[model samples]
Target: MKIEAHDKQIQDIFSLGYFQIPRFQRPYSWERDEVENFWNDIINDVSENYFIGSMVVYQERKPYFGIVDGQQRLTTITLMLSAIRNSFLRLGEDNLAKGVHKFVEQPNIDNEAEFILDADTSFPYLQDHIQSFNGLKIDCDVGIEEQKLKNAFEIICARLEDEVPTSNSESGGQISMFPVDVPDPILKLKEIRDKVLSLKLVFIQLDNKSDAHLIFETLNARGRDLRTSDLVKNLLLSKIKEGNAKLDSAKESWNSLIRKFDDASESEIIDSFLLHFWISEYNYTTDKKLFSAISKYVSEDEKNANDLLKKLNHAAAIYCKLIDPGAHEWSREETDVRESLKALRLFKVKQQSSMTLALLRAYYEKRLTLRNLKACLRKLEYFHFVFNAITSQRSSGVIATTYSSHAISLTGAKGNDDIQAIISSLFNSLRTKLPQYEEFEVKFLELSYLSSKTKNKGIIKYCLSKQFGDKFGGIDINHDAMSIEHIISESTMKDGLSSDVVGSIGNLLLVDEKTNSEELMNLTVSEKIKKLEGKGYPLAKALVGEKFPESSGVQDRARSIAQHLYNSVQL
Candidate 1:
């Protein structure tokens, strides 16, 4: 590879024309505090110097180093230069203004030798600063917040006064500079600017004509964090280079999925889409770890991985379309639609579950048949609520309550085998219940299966509150104090207990913590049952009449409790 080295004069860097800064480059908007911090860093000598990194410029029909990593610094410098130029114009220093203007103007396409003004370049921030300056007036009432911008302008003016060389002419004539006095408020502006420009910064210049893509990957891999979307884009670029038709088709399909969400910027859509993919396909949870893995993998033989990525992209696109027809708009919402999709995808991948997709299909199909968009939207809202309840940091009790509320609406007086079975039951329930009850049904059903242990606890409480209350004397059903004590501890088991015996819901109880600790602590499930029997409340008889009556054996006892719990809560 060819190697070249030269110092990139601060005044000579070109703008990275028309490219939108990717949203994934930084989180949300930089708040005022961060902006103020940046300003403080510039004013203080903490960071004495800044370098605007080199970038690749598509000049003269060939790509060359334009500006790499220093875009932020370069943009800021251009803003300052523009401010200086405007200040000179305001002060009536026409000649000095021209000199300032020389640094801001764009270079001619054919004349590469022209000393184009850096301020005149088409950088967005530079343009905004210049426009702001031109709009300012001494007599105009500027807001307090705008005072910072005004101060920046005044500082630029002072710096101009300090930098422009004085001129004298022969033939008995002398030129005078602008007459603006150095304001005490802006006295330290020159010092701040000089200190900012004096700090040393290192830049490793790679040969522009070499495999720049590989260099870019290496640079990203070295120390910087690559966002999931960035990794996806890099993978896409690598796939395109591989010259595969299927990969190209998949890319186009993915693009179509993103284009559907026209409200979100491309990067926002892409990032959300990639997050969905990583969670679904690779079962990855953290975005950082996923990006790092993909980055490493793509940096290797990205071409060879094209087929797998294409398949994943295709699956992701279909999933996105199903969940978010509005595409980007749906993804951008604060609601956990992406996470919901991720959870759904994981269910499909890990458990062979298709309830989510089935529900979506049922919703749309039902809506189309009934010609009720409002109903569909309502269902969608309920789905959103249930999904959030499960995925959010909800307490197990709260989740169980929410799930029960939703499930009862669908299953009614009869329960089902699984969530999908409940879904069908729910639709039937919806047929009879009022429209408003639909959400309650969905939420109850969704949370019902979140955790078997949680469900069992809820079940035992429901059974005791309905059955043994008052009959069991002063036994207060404290749901909060209820614990799911294993009748036979798994730790003490020789041959593992069957679901009927120790693992069944019948084997569990909603006993108070004090009773559980004092009477049953360290006891095996069989021992605990024996102690409860001694207390004139045989475990089998306690739950026998409630639901499952076959509590004779250990397995039967477990099943009896679970059956009773399940039955008591069935709508």
Candidate 2:
């Protein structure tokens, strides 16, 4: 494999050859923010040269070069130049227009016009609309790639018109790219042209296609630019032997992982799922190093790529259940497990994936009983509440890690007793570090609500939901649908209560949004409580026809509710 590296300015680079985006490459999808950011970077420092990163290309059988990476940047740059050229032409700056147009397209040796970038299906839209922009057709229907390309073009034109003087008089006639005096439109265009031409990139060229693919994988793996899931997918697929069955099986497994989290976007699900899978296997914390960790794991036995794919497929199904248990239709034997999963979701306790994966594997092996799983989940919810909700801290105890390890150990257990023992040991160990009733009571009482702190309100709402569950017999209050209602309006400062005292957890209840807006505000504590009458939530029900003449009375009520919460969850 012969490798060559060189530097080329954008002007010379785009002028020399036509680049083709391969079918495997993702389409142009840069949004308005990204376009504005790029343009801002250019205009912010127009006097000096800037580096725009690197591009990987290989010589195809045809004369054009195939871009293996950096297609998004290259395509956006071409569209930007097209927009600039059309803007110049509209202003009747023919000399400036021609200079910008030359960088976007050129006549070939056969005298046929060729666009500098050929984006396959997006090529026609680019040629007719983007390259030679008249008025953007408002009713034109296009694919996502074409739409994004058009959006980018519009963004560039809009930004340029803002900076440079346009025919429109709505914007103040004072046109300035900088805080100082405004330059002539032609002069500003020339400055932009000169700056873009001075921009440099690392140019990599390869002769062999296979070698280019290897380089693409290596570059992506070493750089944080690529998604971890994409890198891992490429590694697994490339390592498998070239055959229809093996390739199809690997593809199917990857698709299954994607489809597992139907509610989440592809990138979000795959990246998070892979991170959880990594944690389960190694118990190592990571953010961007996931791809490197996965590569190291697969490098140990690359020939077993097919086996790795199969394991991932099975794990994906369990992962789906972890995210949304009620969505997955499990058997009657798994009903208790599903309920536990549902409770975990209601508590909004994510980041237990390691323990979740272990539980899932144990149930898959039929070693864990339904009752024990529910017991473990209930313990986990309480532990999470104490550590996360009340204390506002993560699970830092050594026993927390042991929960995952112990749960994994339960997968191969011999009987129901073994599974129960593991579950008991994990919870018992965690309970040793758990905050006692007194500690929780103090934190609960100290948990003051801030109208601005939405998360605090969410925690308080969950507490009310739990209280409701206890009193109303499976009333199924959707915590998300409920809003925080202050019995003593902080805005009104009812009963001379200060904002903090009025915002205390004791004065708060989760009421329906309609009741909160229509009846709660501008009311005295007694009147609001009367309005809360007949609400299913025990906290709301308790408040009805009650009077708190002083702030201390609200504190006393809050303390009682806190004590009940602590006693209910005691191991």
Candidate 3:
């Protein structure tokens, strides 16, 4: 573990290297808040030697280095410098612009202009939009990260109030920063460039990739500014030789893995999907230890890095399908599986994805039949409804461990018979893992809906729709085709009944909007029950008319409904 450290200003740091953010490094992810914070730091009263933070890099060649830490800061500073240069360029300060531009980008080996801080992910956009300030003919369909780069550059340009053309839309939406008249723009622009060049950072350089990998985890483990998934990717890709064609392939593979999750959110892509896939394929661990575990895992075997990426790509595709039911192509006959998977997502069953991923892969391999797969998924969904949704038990421990164990077992299943055996075991396990009918009855009895809590409302509707069992899929839960009709109305609360009993699960029934509206509003309990009996809808016949509970005796009726739900629940 050798290290060389120096305190360098932003200008000095950029001057020391032809830097490139590695393929594995995260894309520029600073949002308005971070960009705004950096802007404030630049304009705020500060010392000439004001410190930002440390940057960790490993040498690729004499003047080439790969950024391991502080990429966000470096990328941000580069964008700000480009903004300053744009201001100077627009103001006819050619020499001044060239002076500032030297820090933003320098001539590459072919004498072609190149960005000093080239990001592997956003190079074209960074070059065309921010660095080179080229025209809008270049087309790269913007993803989340690219959009952030555009936004950062946009914010900086607007703040600087440069007449620099912004490559916004095809028509190009360009405007000034403030509505008011500006005075003495050159002095303001020089001030910004000077502040940017003045900012100091601790430049920590390592002689080798191994040392950089070793230092990355320590720097990032506890930092609020860390992106752990990107760090994990760095550790995985470190061993691959730079300038090798395989490096490009590996980088593309990583990018493809990221692209599979295009529809998911940033947190979902970087945080949730990465963490969940690691749990499914490797050890069940927290985000805190995931980087370390992955680094060690990759270090242990030469082939592990490629193996892990393959697993991740497969799991990411599966994960997208798991979280969003419509993500995968389900055949007309496979609607049950899609519907049941959606039900699991609605129930907020996350850890079960560990098992579902394995189960789905087995089905994909033809090792498990669709029938058995559907059965296992339905049971998991139903059991989660009982154990997770209704009882609200801890989602971890026995249940999570059980799913993980079954997923592992499914992977090595010998044949169809073996896969079916695991499926049966999974089904029985889910059934037994459910809260005993008595326990469920107790919990279900305590259920009350509040107008403010959306989940509470959802649960009431869910219970009524599936009063007999898993009769409806997620479509029923999410649609507004029906509303809960209070058998004993909220009006009854004024007549001496309690609010809890009024919104209790026992007093609620799913009814069509018309049936639930003023048409049946003024009816007595018996009248409402009678009105529901003749309706030609599924939820209209949700509860047996006679079993409809009275306002005062809601507890007794809650007990009966609980008993029925407990026994009839399809797990």
Each candidate's TM vs. the true structure?
0.42, 0.72, 0.85
The lDDT, on a scale of 0 to 1, for candidate 2 is 0.70
State each model's CA lDDT, in order: 0.42, 0.70, 0.74
Q: Model 1: how large is the Cα RMSD against the reference?
A: 17.0
Ranking by TM-score: 3, 2, 1
Q: Write the per-residue lDDT of candidate 3 for residues 478-508, one digit (tens) a residue.
A: 3447787777877777788787888788777
Q: What is the lDDT of residue 437 in candidate 1?
A: 35
Consecutive 10-residue window with the lowest summed lDDT within model 1: 346-355
- lDDT for each residue of candidate 1 in 348-466, tens digit (9 for 90 to 100): 22111122332333333342222222233334333333333222222333332223344233222232245345545544543432223334333332322112336533433443443
Clash totals for all candidate models:
40, 0, 0
List runs of model 3 lying over 4 Å from the truth. 1-3, 89-95, 137-139, 158-184, 208-211, 240-247, 268-287, 423-433, 450-455, 468-480, 491-497, 514-534, 538-541, 546-557, 569-571
Candidate 1 shows a clash count of 40
Candidate number that wins on TM-score, 1 or 3: 3
Query: How much does candidate 2 score in TM-score?
Result: 0.72
